[model samples]
Target: MVKQTNVKNRKLICDKLLTFQTQLEADYSDKLYEVSRKRYAQIDDLENVHTGFKSAVKREVKSLIPFSDIYKETIKLSFERVDAQYQKVEREYKEIWKEYSDNLSLNWSILAPAVEGMATFCGKVMRVLTSSNEEIDVSKLKSILYLKELNL
Candidate 1:
């Protein structure tokens, strides 16, 4: 009886852990999609606005005398802003991935042994159920059997 209760508790914990893990994965995926969409939008805006301006400047500088030092410095500063934005996006993505991996590792470590033990206990229960010559309580056996099937 105590063994049966332990198995039921382990199965419950495993199911809850698995559900939490699935929810975390879904949240992470949604966050990644949002970040990717925003990144693409930023890239598109840069291409539409800055690319045309840069091309016009290059063409004017080529046809005319030359680019002023101020123009060159302004372009460099614009590029620096782009670089900073890229770095910020990369860091945010890295942090998200780290959090996802840490959560996954912790959940898996806790749930793996519990799941394995539950399986072992179920196997033992099955052996006893099938091999015993005496009659058993069918309701109790069915309840325990249902508990064994609660995967995630």
Candidate 2:
């Protein structure tokens, strides 16, 4: 009778653990999906901002920069800085996804790092972009060339 009770208790514990694991997996997967979707949308908006900035620069800077060597260099440096900012964000985004996928299991708590990294990455791109604009602005460049308003 004791042996039967021990086996039943073990079975009950195992069943409870399995249920918890299943729920955790579902919850983690849902959270990841939702966050990734929002991040992707943000990336799309960033791309649009980049496109608009590029178009404005091409149209405005091309005609303006020829007159001032300092302005030309400033614009070039600004473009490079913006590109680097984009690459950093992209790298962090990929790293989070890779980390999640590689350690995927019942460990939903592991997502804290990924989620925090995601949250921290937010607004950084724009910050970099706008700071670059400051340098451009000092050169007396057009305000239209700056990413003053984010699409988001």
**What is the TM-score of each predicted model, taking all chains together?**
0.30, 0.36
If candidate 1 were superposed on the true structure by all CA atoms, what would the RMSD be?
32.4
> Pairs clashing in candidate 2?
none
User: Candidate 2 lDDT, tens digit per residue, 45-86?
Assistant: 445545444455545544543435434554565566555655
lDDT of 1 by residue, 24-87 (tens): 2343333334435542233333333333433443343233323355335433543454445545
Error of 1 at 57 (Å): 9.9
Scanning candidate 2 in windows of ten residues, the lowest lDDT window is 143-152
